[model samples]
Target: MIISFIGKGGVGKTTITLNLGAALATYLSQRVLVIDGNTRAPNLSFLLELKEAVSLFDLITDPKNIVKANTEIDGLKVISSPIGSNAELDFEVLKSLLSFFNLSFNFILIDTPPSFTSETLTFMELSDYSILILNPEPLSVIEAYRALQIASRMNVKLLGIIVNKFRQDAVVSLEYIRRNFSLPILAVIPEDPMVQTYTLEQKPFSISNPSTPAGRALMELASYLTGRKIEVQLEKRGIIGTFFSLLKKLFT
Candidate 1:
């Protein structure tokens, strides 16, 4: 299945895309491919520390370069876009490529630019499912609502929303969002400082620090997607843990 991760910029779409892909591949042993659809400001390559790698643009120029562009990272196949390339993004070509990729990959996850541009729209329209990522801020939720409206208008199949960078102290609670939006809440990833450290170390927290709150949330999401159960040991955080437990009860 092809799933596109969409939201406003700086809301953690790339982070979720990479970590979720890692979780699916490492734990479920699924054949997953993550494509960097944010051609304008691509960061997946930088995070993976892929120097001078073959990119999606290269494959678009010549379809035969598919084997070369499919680079492996932490058991997941990645087709990252050039960091500063000025190549024109053709949505039609991308559509065809995704169709061809369906034959080989169990999951094709796309990380798109954080806007309602043609690139983002095309990716959403092409996807079999789309997940909206947003932070626990009022403005972010408002933006996500706008995105949901657009996705509905486009007749896109929305899987749900993944609330990234979640904080127990945030003014906007998960229950508030649940009451406001019609879409189901898929996951709520906590704000963990180790995420920055892992990114600096060129690793996904899902694989490098699976015990972290963010990592566990991502693994649960992967499990929800694949219907595969994996044991995850949770660490207690006293009041914070109690708060999230309440939220989980509300969600159920």
Candidate 2:
């Protein structure tokens, strides 16, 4: 399946995509191909800990060079473009390139830009499913809904929504998110410091520390995507926290 990950700039879309790709490759033995569709800010290369070498732009531009350029990191293959490279995207060309990769890879995960740009639209058209990431804040939810509207208009199958950077204390915001969006809440990722630490180190937290709350939730989300019905669990806090968590699920 071609699953595109979308969200606002700071919503951790790339992080979630990398972790989910790692989980699928490590646990399910899937040949996952992660494509960095965000040409302006291609961070997938950095997250894969790879040098900005031959990019997807380089490979797709030359038809005679039919060979796919990718690097295997952890257990998945990644196709990324160098950051700040002004390689414009042609939808037809991109569609052909994705079609080529789709035949060989089990899953194609495209990490897209936040806006409704040409690049993002191309991926949406090519994707079989989309996973929207959002925070518990009102503006984030509003932006997510706008993305959802675009995805629906483009006829992309939305798998679900992932609420990232979830704070246990934000009861009102959480309640608003639950009440507003119509798609299934795939997973609620906690605000964990390890996520930032791993990002700075350019590592996948699910692979490095699966025991952490955010790590475990991401793994469960991976399972859910792979046809398994895994339940998402929150961190165990005190009685007041438990009450709020129960309230968070009322709109589910």
Candidate 3:
């Protein structure tokens, strides 16, 4: 399936896409390919610690370069966008590339730009399914509502919303979102510090720390997408851990 992750900037779309792809590849043993569809301000490659290599733009310029453009990182295939490259994005060409990817990968997940640009629309239009990523904030929720409207008009099959960076004292509650939006709430990923730690370590938190709250949530989301049952054991947070968790909630 070709799935696209859509959301506003800094809403953790890339993080979710990378971790979910890793979870699918590591836990489910599924062949997954993640494409950096954000031609502008692309950072998925940097996050994966991918060195200089052929990128999606290379493949778009020459369709036969798919062999060299495809990179393997953390058990998932990736086609990253060249950082700081100013290449014109062609929607038709991108669509054709996705068709080629669909033949090989069990799942092709595209991380799109934040705004409603042609690039974002092209990814959404090409996707067989789309997942909205948003923070639990009023502004983010409003933007998500707008995204849903766009998806509906484009006839994009939206799987659901994944509430990222969730917290107990979030401005927008999960119940409010469920009551307002017409789609299901796929998962609620907590604000885990381990996410940042893993990022600095150049690793996916879902694969490096699958027992973290955010990690478990990502695994659950991946399981939901695959329609497969996964047994993710809850982490045992003792007294010190509970105190720190409560402290984080109190501060953030």
Candidate 4:
């Protein structure tokens, strides 16, 4: 299975994608391959502390290059951003890369660029489903919808929406997005400081602090995507929260 995480700028898409990718590995206990496909602003290397690693660019540009991606955690592999990144994505080269990499893993998650680009479009087509991450800002919502439109235009199947960095007082709530897009809001990760700490400390939140509310939420979200019966502990936030979530679900 291939899943690509795409969304708006400054919406914690990379951060969430990294942590969620880690969470997905733990949830399934399988060898998971996560690649930083966003060549423009590659933050996955920074977040995961693998800046010097050989990236996709190396794989695409070099025929003689041989590499094996290894992660600190077992059953997880990562292909960090290459030495020299390029904004213009070569669809033919990327398609070749996808075919080469697809043979090595049972599940692969790609951390994508902020907006639709030649690169994003290439990866979107390679993926089985696209996970569109968004915050609770109006512009974020609008851009996410734009991404959904792009997916439709390319005929890519979207997994659903993962609402990260969301706050209740959010200018635009999840309800607005569901009403507008009709996509499943797989999970709403409320605004939390633990996530920030994980970033500062340079550890995947799910791996460093799996019990944190946000970490648990990501795990549950992964379970939902994989069709597992994980307990829904987040139900305690309150009836009003649940009501609005339901309303948003209906609208979406």
Candidate 5:
């Protein structure tokens, strides 16, 4: 499945995509490929701790160069920004990367740059599933609507919106998101400081502190994606079965 995460900046789009890909990586033995489509500020590799992986920038700028894949994490491989320092984005390069020989990955997650840039709009057309990440804030809701408008025009399948930073007393906000988007809130991640702690440690929150409220919500999301009949946990992280063969290869 080609899932692209898009939304306004700082709304946790990258975080969700990173953990989502990570969660899937643990469950499936097939490779999970994550491309840092956020050209302005590519952080998917950083979030997933593949600081040394090849980046999207290079692939987009010069397709002739092979994108070196890194096996930093089990079942996960990454491409980073290849000289993506505010450079003019080449959408065609990205398209080739998505459709190239690497299309056999079990799940491919693309992290888009904030806003509806040409690159993002082009990716919208290429992705089979696009998820807009929204917070309880009004601006984020409007941004989600804008994203929906763009995705609709681009012939993209919007999977659903994920409500991040959910609070107990955010009924009005939730109702607004539910009413405006007219799509189920795919998942609701509660506000928690454990996320901050994980960031400080440069680890995905769902992996480092899988017992937090946020982590369980992520597992539910994984169960939905995988279509696996796994029980959803509320306070503890659900351990997706790992490939024993892959794990042995990982540590050996």
Candidate 6:
């Protein structure tokens, strides 16, 4: 399956792309290839702690360089864009690249720029499935709606929406989002400070802090994608734990 991740800037789209690839590869034993499409400010290389001499741009310029640009770590293969190389690639080249990648990996996950740029639109058009990332903020919701419209126009199969960075006092409810946009609320990831901490440490939260709220949520998402049920007890932090406890009590 080819699934592309999209959302507004600072909405954790790339984070979802990286961690989802990790979860699918690490936990499910699937060979996953993650392609970075964010050319202007690409960070997948930085997040993965990899320094590649060749990148997707090189591959685009010469398809035979595919072997050199591909990076593998712990079962996950990444195709990175050239860092500090802001040249916009031809959309046809990206489509051809994805077609080439699909032959070898079980899954091809793409990380796109915020809006419906030519590159992101091309990805949406060519992808088999799409996972839209949404944060619980007004502007984020608006951008997500625009993304959804673009996906709909491209006739892409939407896997579902992954609501990122949820908090107790969030302005909008999941129900509100669901009613506004008709898509399954696949997962609600809680806002956690560990995400920032892991970013600073150049580690993925799914690996460094898998028991945190966001980690557990992502694990559940991965399980859903792979059709395996694995049990995990998410460790709760002070006030958030108390809040969830109260909600559980009230619901029960």
| TM-score for each model | 0.88, 0.83, 0.88, 0.83, 0.83, 0.86
Stretches off by above 4 angstroms in model 2 are: 62-74, 228-252
lDDT of 6 by residue, 1-252 (tens): 898898898899888888878877777788887888887778787777754555677777786765564444566777777666768777777778878878878898899887778778778778998888999899999999988887787788888999999998999888889999989988999998877766765667775557878888888998998889755444544446545655776799
Best by lDDT: 1
Q: Write the per-residue lDDT of candidate 2 for residues 84-172, one digit (tens) a residue.
A: 87778887888887887788778889899878788888888888888899988767788899998988788888988899999878643
Candidate 3 root-mean-square deviation in Å: 5.6
| Cα lDDT of model 1 by residue, 1-252, tens digit | 999999999999998998899889888888888888888788887666553476787777786676664434545778887666677777788889889888888999999888998889999999999999989898898899999999999999999999999889998999998998888999999998878766865678787668888989999999999999977554444345545655786799
Candidate lDDT values, in order: 0.84, 0.77, 0.83, 0.75, 0.73, 0.80
Could you report the Cα RMSD, in angstroms, for every candidate shown? Answer: 8.0, 9.0, 5.6, 9.3, 6.0, 7.6
Q: Rank the candidates by TM-score, best first.
A: 1, 3, 6, 2, 4, 5
Clashing pairs in 6: none
lDDT of 5: 0.73
- Between candidates 2 and 4, the one scoring higher on lDDT is 2
lDDT score, candidate 6, position 64: 72
By lDDT, is 2 or 3 better? 3
What's the CA error at residue 65 for candidate 2, in Å? 7.6
Better of 1 and 4 by lDDT: 1
Write model 3 residue lDDT over 1-252, tens digit each, in one string.
Answer: 999999998899998998899899888888888888887778787667654455787776776665564344534777787667677777777778889878978999899988988889989999999999999998898999999999999999999899999999999999999999999999999988878767765678787668888989988888888899777555655335645765786799
In candidate 5, what residue range of length 10 has the lowest lDDT sum?
A: 237-246
Off by over 4 Å in 4: 61-67, 229-252
